[model samples]
Target: MARNFAHGNYSHTQKKARNTGRTARDQTRRTLSQNFMVDRHAVDLMVKAAAPEGLVLEPGSGEGALTLALAEAGARVVGYEIDPRLAGQLAARTRNDPRIDVIRGDFTAARAPREPFAVVGNIPYSVTSKIVDWCLRAPDLTSATLLTQREYARKRAGDYGRWSLVTVESWPWFSWRLGDTIGRESFRPVPSVDSAILLLRRRPEPLIRGRRSYQELVELGFGGVGGSVRASLRTRYQGVDAALAAAGVPRDAVVGYVHPDQWITLWERLCG
Candidate 1:
């Protein structure tokens, strides 16, 4: 017999009904990422932290785990699922509930409605980068809660990790944080790698306010930075000079605390 999770203070009839539903899905679980959230404690914590005050968007809302919770917590939810089968399941689950809307589409290619919304998702491992980029590009998305591979979450959150180009570029617009570690057993088919949820909140405005030429400056900075770092010069001083010289950054604007990875901030400072 499979282990039974206690749903406290529930009548016998209710417990039986709930378990039956779970059992039915258990057979089809393989088709779903089916990691069907084993950690109720984590679920509660994620829901509490999200506190979706307004419209909330959930991309890759597999089987509606977080989506249903968000709606129950009084949030207005728009969930996008790439799998038609999962979308159908989600529609069935939320048919009686008016607060949730489920759509079937690829998140990267989909045109999200223009609205101020917070995003949350249990992201597919393969497209984590694209999903993060989408959230960053969506100006109206003020915050995001995402589950990703533990290593990626740690690096993005800057924990014991070197600054990356993506980090520097995104830092000006949002803050990244890793909330909790979820064990491998938490999902169906049990992936070998662990996962964690990350919270990101967008800044009210661009880190620098000026002629919208920051992108160009940043591109130039990276080229200079990359060239110097990859150069054969042994000494650190020589590399710095070479990079700055190659970049053509004005001598008067010499930056002392700059790193090769901080292209976004460096460019903004130089432009100012």
Candidate 2:
């Protein structure tokens, strides 16, 4: 007999039927990108990476695996699930657990808490960017540990030794890193690709001042005007050659090859 943690025990035939039902249900949830984490090891790894404490916000809390794990790890969790059935089930399941509050809604649309909090979840693949944007915009969000596509995580974390425009733009305020990778088999309805944990922790003190101007500089560098970052920036800043030298950036360096720290140095030299 196989035990369905979310539901209950099932015989072999019943398990087959349940799987079929899930496949059908998953068809309708394509827009939601509902891939439920079914592996306990994967759940444990996410919880460990997050090391969640105090208040935590969980997005796309399908089947309550991560939500329950987060609560067990001694954090007060507010889990948002867009699927009404899953949300209702989770709500009912955790009704007696004071630490867990299941909300049937969109996590991206939820308002940031006045007090400092952390966001942790196995988020929907389709809306990972949106949820990340929300976390970055929240003034009181101390950190976020999310399960996202491996490629997306690597890009944001600069795992491939190349920086992204968004990562550089936000680097002054948040530090991004890649955590453990979860195989596709970890999910109930296995996705085509593996997933990895993307960790973003807000800097206690921002690396730079004048965010608006710094972002503008970053934007101009990535605008692809004169090809290389050095040439592109020269169009706007007269001393760009000297600035690149000060930042240790090659005159012919591409924008994506420039590290965030180098970008900061460039900003200081050119705009400070």
Candidate 3:
């Protein structure tokens, strides 16, 4: 027998012979955290951003909602899901598409595809930042559209606030935007919180080089220290003064807000 979880409430089915009245292991909601996207409009927006071009990868392909959409858009879509049941269903759903491939595995641990690809998915909120970092480190990733927590979406887009690490790190390689929010009611088992979609596009080349210059600078700005990496140059250069001066940053501008490439100019001049 199947139990039901709806409107944020968990309800078990009638008890039968030897039935403990709990949902089956596969049917029981996993504690993956905040699986809250039931809106078609939100799905449409993510697909639109991806544009269904070339090869596309979707991590956390829950229930195949967005996966079907991407396949319909004519993209060669590969979806990875950690849940075996979900993966099996998704695989069946898109098996005939030929362009779609479904993998059952942990996306965070999964190796990136050899070919260049774009990524799309409604990511698990708990590990959103780690996924973002994975996207950044992927050498051949072209772009990504992820449905994440609204707060994280804002931070990633740097919407009218100080740049978070994601914003600073991905600025040169990818641009980000916070799209619409999906309400709590949309999900089968409604989550306590809502979600927002974030779109990211990868850069063509390295924005700044010096081994780990941008990474180190970002660490410093955020008050993290490993090798004097956390010391803010903001006070020393009066903003980006130290970085700018060291990089021979020609103009009287700050390196912090400058494009990653321009910041590279400073790094090359100063650190090299």
Candidate 4:
């Protein structure tokens, strides 16, 4: 049974089971994705990496591990959790503290903040991409530290030279870093895949000033115009071959080899 912690009286009690014994392994609510992190070491790492101050936003707060950790690290925290049971636990744990707030619902649907805040989440795997978009577009965002699938973290950091559309588009503003792995055993339910932290720090000044044309350029190059950067851009815009030459990119070089520096040069010549 779920306990009530809504009256502002915080107390410690035995943790409740997620559901009745029957069908415990099966998925529950369609809207809620719950994975309570159980590893203290990994939790410590997240807190240290965040080194949070000011406001911190957490999605899928679960049982308050990240929320409490971040708050103790000096950040005023607001966490979103769709599970009533877990939400109640989180509320009870942090109610006496002035540094924390818990909201029960879908974070993706919430009105994002306009005041500068740092984000830290042991996020739901289902909404990882959505959270990435939310933080990147947040007008007041300072930095984001997210726990995501290892593969997702790698792509965001351009580990294999394969970047997502969001990664490419947000590159000028945020620098993405892949951090230490959190094993499957780190969670209570033991997810099939391992998770890792992704650190994104907003650049002081974008390597290239933010521009709408950059989005279009990302689509043209990565959207299968051709395998090579030279062929991709040259086919869509005039003088791209000459631009590539000026940027010091080889005509036959793969898009993977074309660095961010190259993209900036090409953008200036073609779109500026």
Which sections of candidate 1 miss by over 4 Å? 1-35, 210-213, 224-265
Best by lDDT: 2
lDDT of 3 by residue, 99-162 (tens): 7788876677767778888889888887898788888889888888888878888766766443
Worst 10 residues of 4 by lDDT: 4-13
Q: 111-225, model 2: which lDDT tens digit per residue? A: 8899999999999899999999999999999999999999999999999999999899999999999999999999977899999999999999999988998999999999999
Better of 2 and 3 by TM-score: 2
User: Which has the higher lDDT value, candidate number 2 or candidate number 4?
Assistant: 2
Q: Worst 10-residue stretch by lDDT in candidate 2?
A: 1-10
Using Cα atoms with residue i matched to residue i, what is each candidate's TM-score against the true structure?
Answer: 0.72, 0.91, 0.74, 0.86
- Report the C-alpha displacement of residue 102, candidate 4, in angstroms: 0.4
lDDT rank, highest first?
2, 4, 3, 1
TM-score of 2: 0.91
Per residue, candidate 1 scores C-alpha lDDT tens digits across 46-151 of 7877777688888767767788888888889888775555777887888778798887666676555588888877777778899888888886888988878889
Model 3: pairs clashing at backbone N, Cα or C within 3 Å:
173-203, 237-241, 246-270, 247-270
Each candidate's lDDT (Cα)?
A: 0.65, 0.88, 0.66, 0.79
